[model samples]
Every structure is written in C-alpha cells, then in structure tokens.
Target: MTVFDLPARLDATNAPAIEQQLLRLIQTDKPALLVCNFAATDYISSAGLRILLLAAKTLRQQGAELQLRQMQPAVADVFRLAGLHGVLNIQN
Candidate 1:
C-alpha cells in the first residue's frame, strides 16, 4: 500500500499539478493499493473530483486500487453530490 497526503485545497489552481503527481506515482510505483489521505483537505472543486476520477480509472486499468480516506464531511459531500461516491473507493 502507498499512502499520499492531499493538500488543504483542491481546486483548478492545483488540480493539474496534483494529477501529474498522482499519475507519476501510479506509473512509477505501480502499487497494488494507493490511499489518498484527505485529513487536511477541506475543499474540493470539480477539477479536483475530475483528477480523482481519472486517477481511479487509471489505477483500475492497471489492476490497482485507489482509496480516499479521512475526507472532511464537506469534501465527502461534494463527491456524493457529484455521484462519484459510488464510483470511487472512499472511506470515512
């Protein structure tokens, strides 16, 4: 398992960069399980959700898994409202 800590804010301003980092990690490490820690993240814009969805897809293609953990209630709500809660592996 590989664990990654997310930034406090996930918006268009940093979504692209975060995407690159996640892609790089998945490509380089090829971990069977990738866990993103959202303990510090309180905000998530649509852009952030997009990257996460992309990451989850990419990981699935590699027969790996992406897990989101400790998300704030608000952030989790964003995912839920976007209908991503069922698509991604999120753990409260």
Candidate 2:
C-alpha cells in the first residue's frame, strides 16, 4: 500500500505535479493499493478530478486500485457532483 498526502488545494496549477507523482508510482513496482489522503484538501477543480480519474484508470490497467480517503466536504461534493463516486473508491 502506498499513500500520497494531497495538498489543501488541488486545482489546475498543481494537478500536473500530482499527476506526475502518481504516474511515477504506476511505473514503479509498488503495491496494488494506492491511497490518496485528502484530509487537507478542501478544493479540487475539474483538472484535479481529471488527474484522479486518469490515475485510477492507469492503476486499473495495471491490475491495481486507487482509494481516496478523508476528503473534505467541498472536495467530496465535487466528486459526487461529477458522478465519480461510481468510478472511484472514496472514503469519507
């Protein structure tokens, strides 16, 4: 299991950096479970959501999984609004 502590703001500005990090993880021989801790994240833009979805897709292709945990209310709402709860594993 590998975990990433997401920042407080996940917008277009920082989404790419996060994406690179996740991509590196995917390229490595890591565990199947990748956890993103969003305890500090209160906002996430569409770009951020896209990154998450991309990460999830890549992990799935690698026979792995992605788990998002401790999401703030606002961030969680964004995910819900995007109807991504069905595609991603989110834990309140």
Candidate 3:
C-alpha cells in the first residue's frame, strides 16, 4: 500500500502539481493500492475533483486501487455535492 498525504487545500492553484506527483508515484512505485490521505485536507475545488477523478482512472487502468481516506467534513461535503461520494472510493 502506498499513501499520499494531501495538502490542506486542493484547488486550481495546485491540483496540477499534485496530479504530476501522483502520476510519478503510480508509474515508478507501482503500488497495488494507493491511498490519498485527506486527514489534513479541509477544502477541495472542482479542479481538485478533476485531478482525483483522473488519478482514479489512471490507477484503475494500471490495475491499482485508489482509496480516499480521512476526509474532513468540508472536503467530504464537496465530494458529496459533486456526486463523487458514489463514484470514488471514499472512507471515513
């Protein structure tokens, strides 16, 4: 299992950077499972959601699983509002 700790905020300003880093991890490390730890993440925007969706898709294609964990209420709500709570593999 490989875990990536996300920043407090995931938005348009930094989603691309995070995406690149995650892609590198997926390509180089090739972990069977990837966990995006949102314990410290308080906010996430549409761009962030886009990145997560992309990551999930890429990981799936690689035969790896992506799990979103420890999401703060606000961030979780964002996912809920975006209807991603069902699309993404999220855990409390």
Candidate 4:
C-alpha cells in the first residue's frame, strides 16, 4: 500500500498537477492499494472530485484499489453531496 498525504485545499488551481502526480504514481508503482489521506484537506471542489474519480478509475483498470481516509467533515460532505461516497472507498 502507498499512502499519499493530501494538501490542505483541493481546488481547480492544483487539481491538475495533483492528478498528474497521482496518475504517474499509479502507472509507475502500480501498488495494490493507494491510500489518499485527507486529514489536512478541509475543502474539495468539483475539480478535486474529478481527480479522485479519474484516479479510482485508472486504479480499477489496473486491478488495484483507491482508498480515501481521514477526511475532514467538510470534505467528506462534499463527496457525499456529489453522491460519490457509495462509488469510492472512504474510511474514517
């Protein structure tokens, strides 16, 4: 498993760069599990959600898993509001 600590804010400004980095990690390392720690993330915009979904899809295609953990309530709520909580693996 590979654990990635996310930034405090996930918005359009940085989502693209983060997406590239995440994709690179998935393609190069190909870990069985990729854990994205959202302990420090207080906000997640739609762009951020898109990145997560894309990463999850890429991992799924490779037969791996994407696990999101330690999310702040606000960030978690964003996922819930987007109806993504059921689609992704999220842990307290």
TM-score to native of every candidate shown: 0.98, 0.95, 0.97, 0.98
Top of the candidates by TM-score? 4
Q: Over the stretch 4-35, how does candidate 2's per-residue lDDT look in tens digits? A: 89998999999999899888977885669999
User: Candidate 3 — number of clashing residue pairs?
Assistant: 0
Clashing residue pairs found in predicted model 2: none
Off by over 4 Å in 2: none
TM-score, prediction 1? 0.98
Model 4: which residue pairs collide?
A: none
- For model 4, the run of ten residues with the poorest summed lDDT: 72-81
TM-score of 2: 0.95
Poorest 10 consecutive residues of model 1 by lDDT? 83-92
Error of 3 at 92 (Å): 0.9
Model 4 spans > 4 angstroms off: none
At residue 36, give the lDDT of candidate 1.
97
lDDT of candidates 1 onward, in order: 0.95, 0.90, 0.93, 0.95
Between prediction 2 and prediction 3, the one with superior TM-score is: 3
Q: If candidate 3 were superposed on the true structure by all CA atoms, what would the RMSD be?
A: 0.6
TM-score order, best first, reads 4, 1, 3, 2
lDDT (tens digit, per residue) of candidate 4 on 1-92: 99988999999999999999999999999999999999999999999999999999999999999999999998989999999989999999
Looking at model 3, which ten-residue stretch has the lowest summed lDDT? 77-86
| RMSD of candidate 4 to true structure, Å | 0.4
